[model samples]
Target: MNQKLKKQDWTVRVLQELERQYSPSRWSHRMSADDVIKAHVKALKEGTEQARDLAQTLLNVPYGEGDGEKLDVYIPKTNSLDVHLVVYLHGGYWQFLSKEESGFMAVPLIDKGVVVVAVGYDIAPKGNMDLMVSQVRRSVVSVVQQYSHISGLYLCGHSAGAHLAAMVLSTDWSQYSITPQIKGAFLVSGIYDLLPILSTYVMEPLKMTEEVAVRNSPSKLVPQLKLSSSSCQIVVAVAENDSPEFRKQSEEYYKALEESGLSVTMEDVANTDHFNIIEQLVDGEYHLTKVHR
Candidate 1:
C-alpha cells in the first residue's frame, strides 16, 4: 500500500482498539438481557444528560415533539439571527453523548446570535447506523419545517457526528424537494473510512459490514455528488492534539473534497484535543472562523 493508505490503516486500527474499550456494547455484555438495547440507551441517556447539565442555563428545544430526537438550543436569549441554522452533531463514536453534551460547545455560537441546534439521536446496537442517521435526517427536516424563516442550513459535527453531518450536506436536495439550501458543512475530526475500524472493538456496536461501511463513507460518496451538487462549502477540521485516527480522516477527507472541486477548507488547530476542539467553534479562537471561509 502507498504511504497514505498504510497510514490510514494504522490509524483505523488504533481507533478500533480504543472503541472496543469504551463502546457501550462492552457494558451490555455484562447486563445479560434479551433487550439490553433499552439498558444501553438508558445508560447513554444518563451520561448524555450529565454532559448537558455540565453547562449552566441551557434551553431545551424540542425540534420534534415530546423529546423524540430533541435538539438543545444554547444561544443567547437576545433572539437575533439572520444566517444559516448551525446544527451541531455530537460525536460519541456514534453510540454515546447527546444534544446535551454538544450544547456546551454551542454556548459560544449561541451567544454569537447564530441559531445553533445540537441534534441528539439514537445510537448503534439498539438500532444500527441507518437508524442513527435517520434520526438526524428527521431532525433536520423538522427544523426546516418548524422554523420556516431560516434561509440556510449549515452543519457542524465532531468525530462520528462530523461524518454524519458530511453525509447530510452531501445529500441531493433536489431529490428530496427541500427548499432551503444546505449552505455549508463543517466536519471536525470525522471518520470517512471504516476498513481499519472493522473487525475491531468498535464494530460490535456499529455492526458495520463491509458493504454498509463503503456505502456510508463520505470519501466514497463525495465523488458521486457532482451531478446534483456543485456549489457546497465543506470545511474539514482537525486539532493538533487529536488522535492519529482523527487527524488521518480530517486531512484525507479535506484533500478528497478539495480535489473534487468543492470549496474545501482544512484547519489544523493548536493545543486542542478531540473533545474540546468543538469548543473552538464558539470561542472564535479556534479554526472554525477559518472554516467559515
Candidate 2:
C-alpha cells in the first residue's frame, strides 16, 4: 500500500476498536445511555438545588472575561478559620453539562466544612480544545487569587472533566502570576488520551485535529505534571464496570505519573459504572465521598 493507503487502513482499524472501547454505555448493564444521562442530570439538579439551600453560595461568579468563564461557589454554613476549597469540573464529553447542574457533590462536602466551586467553560461548537484548556487554567488561577488565604486547594473532575483536571496539573504556572497551592486531585472515569476520541462520534462537535489531540492529551503531558504538580496527591479512579479502555487509560496514566515520581494512586471503585460512580458523590457515606473526606 502507498503511504496514504497505509494511514487510511490504520485509521479504520483504530476507529473500530476505539468505538467499542470508548462506548461506556454499552458496558453498562444497569441502564441504557439515555437513561443513565437522565438519571445523571436529575441527580445533578436535585443535588445542586439542595446544596444551594444548605450552603452560603455565590452563584455565577466570573473567573474570566468569557461568557462561559464563570463558577458557582458553595461555602459551608458554619464558618471555619481553616478552609479547603475543591474546584469541580463537570463532564458531558465536553459538549454538555454546566455549572448549574455540577454542584451536587457540594451538598455533602459543604456539611464537612469544605467549600466547593463548580467551574464552567465553553463546551463544543462554541469553544475549541485549546480555549477550554486555557479557560480552565485561568479559572484555577482566579480561584487562588480570590481566596488568597485558603488552607488548601483541591481539584475534582469526571470523564472529560477529568481530562481537563489532568491538564491543569500539567500547567506551566510560570506563565501565570500565581501558582496555585494544589493539595490533591480526584480524577474519576476520565478520558486521558484524546487521540482515540478524534476518531469517535464524540469528535463531531469538538472538531479536534491530530495535532490538537496530541497536545491536549494528559497522558502525553505527564512530564510537565512531574515538574509542576509533583507535590500534589492525585487519585485516578475508575468505575469497576467502566469500559475496558477507560480502565486501561487510568492504569497507564497512573503508571506514567508514578514513573515520573509524582504522588499518584489508582482506585477501582466497585459495583459502579461511569455515571453513578460520580453521581454517588451526592451521598456523604458513599465510598468516594468518604475517600474525599
Tell me, by lDDT, which candidate is best.
2
Taking the tens digit of each residue's C-alpha lDDT, what string does model 1 give over 1-99?
599999999988877676643332332333443354354345445544543444333356565453446777544445444545777788778776666
lDDT of 2 by residue, 195-278 (tens): 878778889999999999999999999988888898999999999999999999899999988899888888899999988899
> How many residue pairs of model 2 clash at the backbone?
0
Q: Give candidate 1's error at residue 203 in angstroms.
A: 0.9
Residue 72's lDDT within candidate 2 is: 98
lDDT of each: 0.66, 0.91
Worst 10 residues of 1 by lDDT: 21-30
Candidate number of the best TM-score: 2
Q: lDDT of model 2 at residue 35?
A: 84
Model 1 regions lying over 4 Å from their true place: 1-68, 78-83, 174-179, 227-229, 289-293
- Candidate 2: Cα lDDT at 49: 95
